[model samples]
Target: MDRTLTTATTAKIADAATAGSAHAVGLAEWLTRRAARAPHKPALTCNGITWNYGELIERIERMSAVLAAGGVTPGARVGYLGLNDPMFVVVLFATARIGAICVPLNFRLSGQELAFIIGDAGVHTLVVGEEHIAVIDAVRTDLACHCFIHRGGAVPGWESADALMAGARAERSLPVAVPVRADDVAVIMYTSGTTGHPKGAMLTHGNFWANNLNEMFLWDMVSTDVTLNFAPMFHVGGLLCGSMATLLAGGHLMLQRAFDAEAVLHAVAAHRITVSFAVPAMLLFISQHAAFEAADLSSLRLIAVGGAPMPEPLLRLYGARNIPVHQGYGMTETASMITFLHPDRSSDKLGSSGTPPLMTEIKLIDASGEPVTAPGATGEICVRGANVMPGYWNRPEATQASFTPDGWFRSGDIGYRDAEGFLYVCDRIKDMVISGGENIYPAEVESVLYDHPDIAEVAVIGAPDARWGERVVAVVAPCPGKSITLEGLHAFAEGKLARYKLPKELRIVDALPRNSTGKVLKATLRVHNVATATGSP
Candidate 1:
């Protein structure tokens, strides 16, 4: 049977599912519908436990009851801090069930950072895993959250989620799912905020629904497909990119607490996983694993990759194994993916980020705000779509500055379209380095250095220079048993890159600093470089 769903077929399925419903767009409704249709089907698996659709929905309903009983009403903010687990998914649906907004906190953030977000969102109730309870405790006095619920074993002052859920089930009084409009806010996802404090992006139920439709149009997702999701669920790439889409399609989702390259290989083979999502760094680690060549990965039909471009070497490695890696472009503000390069065209397009999804529109605009119509003419990428967030939560000025007067959401990334309309992302507007009188994109420079045998990982950043205003600096994590020097790097790239684009300095490190989602922290690197240069502690 053909698994690919056409746009009209997917729309019909959605319409039929919600024909008479007033609150059809609420995300929790999707689980309810799926459970009614396929109660016995495996829906989620984590840490050797599997929950079918029926059991999953029951858990969500009970959790919803517990939250409502604890004073979480419509429009309230509920924060969740934990590793990737079925509970995270449950809390998201449970919060949405009662017309509350889910705030997924990054597990890797410091206590201070987490406190800022919890306070900013004015979270009424916060759910956390036992491992993270201490972090929350450190900042408990600073937060306004009234209720603390623990996911695992009991804590001193926190309510036990397991016990509350048991009590809720015994009561047999499931609260009726609240009605929500399509544009009603369902989640307040905070950005990474490399420059300043993170801003919460208010994503509506319709934004997620539109993203799911876009994924269904691009991927051959089916009920039988088993998906492995090990990326951090706090990020858009991990949650909406493939995990939620799989659940919506009635597919099995195998969750991992965190990414372990060897374990990922074993799970794919043991479970015959068919679909997954990861960043390029995860793919590189998987490819470099000792068992990669021998692992049985034939069951994987699609591996949706975002966060960064997949290096050519990794793409070829996966290609030889017959596993397709689809590259996509998106951010927290865009729900998940705006553009997806089909695997069939991966080779031809090479570095392109594919075309906009079915319900999204993308354009490029010059610095003067005029359309950049000619192919290969680089400009700031812009997007206009239902999937786009309405605005940053409670920050009207920031939201206004992020969009054009006509309503297109400015992406802040520099890119250009080929004649075929495929987007080639150059670099972020802020990351672009201007030296003397010329413009340079660090991504372009990093792409070249990535091919060097001695470089295991590299990030190109600009450092202040006396003569040129700014100079290119290559920060490299050398391959094991290898070392690199500025002279050697220049020699290797002499012919490949322009003289001005070549790195003016080299800094060797054991590993590059990265966020949980595997994006190199260039801002951190720049700050560290400045401190070292100035001999600051």
Candidate 2:
């Protein structure tokens, strides 16, 4: 059966049974319930403005009316280009309330890239933030989207988002009633697409709801907790972990426009935030800053880190301060986290990404596609759960290729599980180097390199070789005012790594290029090496 047709049929049956009150369990309904349960509790805070649950719900309903008036129909795609502001959240829930799919475009993308996403998603209406007005204007002619709703700093011809909300509020109009089903797609998030063109991961309402349950159960979050969100909302990490999780718990969310080491520290101190989700690089910067030692982090109960591995030294630094750095492992396809190393076990299970939640199942498979049951046996990590995305939007072949015969979603990450079921990520399947018939996971070698005192950052990639098929190459970024030699690195890794696993070549660089989420762009590095050696522009 056609997916949209099935959804429409289900919605009709549900709406008829409950008189249009039977819309599926989605983020919009989640917010409505929270408002009814605790109307006076703080829902969101940003730019020094606070909104209680009742106020936030009212605004979302009005925004829904605005979208409805603008001709956004159920199942239509609505795009949002903005920073990490409250308006982003408002638009997110508002779209869901009216049964529209929300596509939040990456602000860091070039005009061409942004235009591609906007065009591909078939977004008829756009909500733009002040910071990205010029970017959208440049690509406006190239895009197929219509009806721009400016969030702030409005251009002369664009409609004011705030004015629309005020008008809706004054009119006291309710949102157009529509039946949104659980299986309906709520978001179409474009992946980073490290290898090729980006693909949009279609996350259904059920997928996101299951992910929220996983977070609340694994992290032990409660309604009283105050979470701080600094990551960009365009990413799944920020959307699910920072915003959705907090709201699902009926907790207050303190939003930051963007990440600044000092600003994050100040927000935590001022807001008495109980939890924060950051990338490993963000944690490293925060720990090394001067304000870190003086910042009052007494109220912080958890610091969950993801995007990349947390260096051992940084993990130890937080452990010494009586703080735990919980490691998380997931990707856009899994709706953020598939496993989370609990804070209490962070030290004991160092480098482990913990166990899957009650609703999820994880396993590994060898190259031949057989299951790896032996303890500590490495294989491609596969996940089975409701949290897994439905499929990549409009990419049927890619979507079919991403799953196993039995329906497990292939994670593309090579990893293993210990005797106790704790997951340890080895490396990406593409990143593992086969040198002279020996398999060398770069993450293992990189973990050892991180201990070198003179090395600030490191990325291990496989360079082409005539003798070994592939050679292990270490791209080193030196510590401030410090440098490292090839001999020094070998000496440091002598006992820590096997002979075949050691890096055979060292290339010094000032810094490694990272994406907005702080994961080193290894693909970019690989391309640069090839371009330089071949003298290609």
TM-score of each: 0.80, 0.78
| Global lDDT scores for all candidate models | 0.84, 0.80
The alpha-carbon RMSD values of the candidates against the true structure, listed in the order shown, are: 11.5, 11.9
* Candidate 1 per-residue lDDT over residues 1-537, each given as its tens digit: 122333433343344455568676679987677666666689899999888876777778779999999999999999999999899999999999999999999886667768889999999999998899998898899999989998976679999998888788513566767889899999999874434467899999999989988887789678898999998888887889888888888999999999899999999999999999987767877888899999999899999988766777778989999998999988789998878899899999999999999989999999999999899999999999999999999899989989999999998899999998999997676676655423466876787789999899998888766445467888888899997888888888765555777888888788999999999989899888532221101
**CA displacement after TM-score superposition, residue 419 of candidate 1 (Å):** 0.9
The sequence of per-residue lDDT tens digits that candidate 2 reaches over residues 188-227 is 9987443335679999988888888888887788899999
Error of 2 at 285 (Å): 1.2
**Best prediction by TM-score:** 1
Regions more than 4 Å wrong, model 1: 1-19, 432-537
**lDDT at 446 for candidate 2?**
82
Model 2 spans > 4 angstroms off: 1-24, 170-172, 431-537
